[model samples]
Target: MAPGLPTPKKYFVTAGAAEGSTPLNAFDNALLAARIGNVNLIRVSSILPPGTEFDPNLELPPGSLVPTAYGYIISTTPGEIISAACGVGISRESFGVIMEFSGKCTAQEARAQIENMIREAFARRGMELVDMKIEAVEHEVKRIACALAAVPLWY
Candidate 1:
């Protein structure tokens, strides 16, 4: 609620994995693969504001300041596995909760962690979870690799 900082009205979930010559590059490429590398991401906490809707076909403007909740892992050890995951738990008639996790693990494991975290968050808030969405990615390191999962909120 400021002049140039408007509240987000829509959101989307995505995941990607990539290998690169360096760690940063791997992360950037992973974001690009996730379709969010062009914009400037302003990392935010794990709360989906009330009334925000989910849009899977969101096309963000390049260089825009996008608010996001994300988790990522970059590994340089060759053959090592890395994973990231994000989950959103929607309440019946109110705000939702977002959770992200990343580490040396499989995508399935990361997904499991995110799911449990979402459940715990809902329980802590005493909110009724009516819907859930999750995304995950896994990467196997060659030189350097990155796995990323994100929930990008936008207008």
Candidate 2:
């Protein structure tokens, strides 16, 4: 790649490792969110082409979702899910994820690489590998809401 040349877009993958949503005020909740926000480097593949449209509600490449081309986005919170996948009318159990091209790789290559990476990540975390029903669609990029609201948790 030459300097000033159009480089492939980079996307970041982030998620809360605690499996599901926790009590809002719980220390684990805050810790997980912080951990998710701190992920600076992640392995991504160039799969889908840039400017691919996504579901109007599930905005991929949103500012809140670590910025990745092909990767996973886990969240127990509704906001994170919507920001990550641009998916609308989805249930909370539907984990947030997006796969865009990373470098100059084709969509297939990017998808394969990302799938493997996600599988490995799951194994390392001792979590079962569940399949995701992903669909490709054209969508416009929109401003993301990065706010993580502090929901009151009463126990």
lDDT of candidate model 2 versus the reference = 0.29
Query: Relative to the unseen true structure, what is the C-alpha lDDT of residue 129 in candidate 2, on a scale of 0 to 100?
Result: 45
* Candidate 1 lDDT over residue span 31-54, tens digit each: 999999999999999799899999
Per-residue lDDT tens digits for candidate 2, residues 1-155, read 65762333322222222223333333243224524332332333323223333321332321242323322222334323221121111112322233322222233444455455555554554555444333221111122212121111010
Instruction: Give one clash count per candidate, in the order shown.
Output: 0, 18
Q: Which clashing pairs does model 1 show?
A: none
lDDT by candidate, in order shown: 0.93, 0.29
TM-score for each model: 0.96, 0.28
Of the candidates shown, which would achieve the greatest lDDT relative to the real structure?
Answer: 1
Score residue 130 of candidate 2 by CA lDDT. 44
Q: Which regions of candidate 2 deviate over 4 angstroms?
A: 1-101, 133-155
